[model samples]
Target: MKKQTKKGAAASRDERRMQQVFHALSAPPRRAILKYLAASSLTAGEISSRFDMAKPSVSQHLTILKTAGLVSRDKRGQYVHYALVKQTVETALMGLLTDLGAMPPAAEDKPLAEQDPSSPTAGRARKSGVATETDLPPAEKPAPAQMSMF
Candidate 1:
């Protein structure tokens, strides 16, 4: 086995941390907690109050968020205030978007249709007087059939 260098160890840790962040973000409750923390720091109780779930449940979600490095907690005498690690979340999200090629090109670049007519997306543009699915009315449901017991 090769010896692990400090940089290698750090990279491994970072990869694990990113995995944890993705896992933590997978749940709706945890995402909601992150959204709340994004606006302002709140105590566990304050955070719990926003959801219908039990305080412990909310706390569990907060714990996951905290473990992912997406949130940070500060103790102030009696209460522990939780806040979003905005930079980390933003960095992770931007990296994901970049990886997925979801970011639009700069203004200097032409639109896909204009740049390449042979591209599949270029030919998909709606022609004039065409009735697409959205233009049609909703289909009506049929009436239930009468049942007779013999």
Candidate 2:
């Protein structure tokens, strides 16, 4: 049926979009670019100045991000300004999490940081006899082991 074909085509598009998003996120430079754009839109040169790499490399990263729908570009005069597409990135990531059934239950009304420390769920690991960092007294806390450079 035409409906089934359309559904298949839509699914294919979604799959490609997800792949692009994940690929864009896999690179450290691209992630850094996204973080910079998150604060405010900046010209391509401004973004390139933040990193030690060549401008063309930064531009390539930006191009990949734009293709992934994670960033938008606007040309003003001779400069191209880049901005993060927060909603698109969030939607793509949340979609992947939903598809994998990894999304947290909606019943969690508050984030972990906002939850009361005395609440039943707050220290479930400690309650189960698992020794977390906070459970150890100051004197009894184990020092971090250092690795040898040799």
Clashing pairs in 2: none
In TM-score terms, candidate 1 sits at 0.63
TM-score for candidate 2: 0.66
Indicate the worst ten consecutive residues by lDDT in candidate 2: 107-116
Off by over 4 Å in 2: 1-4, 104-150
Candidate 1's residue-wise lDDT over 31-63, tens digit each? 888888877999999988889999988888888
Models 1 onward score TM values of 0.63, 0.66
Model 2, 1-150: lDDT tens digits are 445588899989989998999999999999999999989999999999999999999999999999999999999999899999876776776676667777664523333322356644456543543334565456767888999999
RMSD of 2: 9.5
Model 1: residues >4 Å from true position, as ranges? 101-150
